[model samples]
Target: MTFANVGTLGTKPGKRDEVVAILTRRNPQLESAGCLLYEVGTNDDEPDTVFVAELWTSAEAHQASLSLDTVREAIAEAMPLLSGQMGGDRFTVAGSPLRG
Candidate 1:
């Protein structure tokens, strides 16, 4: 089944753009690792928050990408800009019978 992750980042004031830039720079590695869809954007109601939506071919592929040194480094760098704990959830896609 396809895997999807939705993450919320609570960035410090004035650091949203910088955080997004850093994330954007690191996105290529994820895309190369079977990320079918990757999107990052700020919350409309909360400008200081950033949201990431990612879809991967499988959970294993997503886990492998997380194990990369570059990914770890990027996450470490982003930690300081955060105002609160970063959290996310993973989901498995279920196809609709009507769409098949």
Candidate 2:
């Protein structure tokens, strides 16, 4: 089944843009695997938050991404810019209008 991951990456008071930049730069690497859709977003009301939405071919694919060299490198580079805790949810894809 397809897997969906959605989360917020919190940064320091003024580090959201920097974090987004890093994630943006690493977008291709993140999507180079079984990823179907990968999106990064931020809220103006929540300047310290960066949101990521990912769709993988399967849960295994998502799990395997953790071991990917590019992902590891992205994490290492983005760690210092992180201030608050990282949190996310994983879901099984049922249906979605965008998928059509």
Candidate 3:
């Protein structure tokens, strides 16, 4: 099944722009590493909060990408900007029993 991940990033005040820039700059490399869909945006009312949605072909693919040097570097770069915590969840796509 396809895998999906939704993450919420809580950043320090005035750090949203920097956080977004970091993620945006890494988008191409992430996409090339089997990230089918990737999105990053700020919460309307919570200016310091950023939300990211990602989709990959499979859970294994996602995990493999995480181990890539580029991804590891990006995570290290982003860690300091976070204020509260980063929350994320993984899910598997669902399909009708009869369809399969």
- My TM-score estimates for the predictions, one after another, are 0.82, 0.88, 0.84
Off by over 4 Å in 3: 95-100
TM-score computed on alpha carbons, candidate 1:
0.82
Model 3: lowest-lDDT 10 consecutive positions: 91-100
Instruction: Write down the lDDT of every candidate, Cα atoms only.
Output: 0.86, 0.87, 0.85
- List model 1 lDDT by residue over 9-51, tens digit each: 8899989888898788845777788888878998668888888
The most accurate candidate by TM-score is 2
**Of candidates 2 and 1, the better by lDDT:** 2
lDDT of 2 by residue, 1-100 (tens): 7899999998988989988887877456556679988888999999989999989999998899899887888889889999867899999999889756
1-100, model 3: which lDDT tens digit per residue? 7789999999998898888988878456677778888899987798988899988988888999988887788789988998977798889978547557
On a 0 to 1 TM-score scale, where does candidate 2 land against the true structure? 0.88
* Model 2 lowest lDDT segment of ten: 24-33
Q: Per-prediction RMSD in angstroms?
A: 2.5, 1.7, 3.2
Candidates 1 and 3: which is better by TM-score? 3
Clashes of each: 0, 0, 0
Model 2, which residues run further than 4 Å from truth?
Answer: 26-29
| Pairs with steric clashes in candidate 1 | none
- Full candidate order by lDDT, most accurate first: 2, 1, 3
At residue 21, give the lDDT of candidate 3. Answer: 88
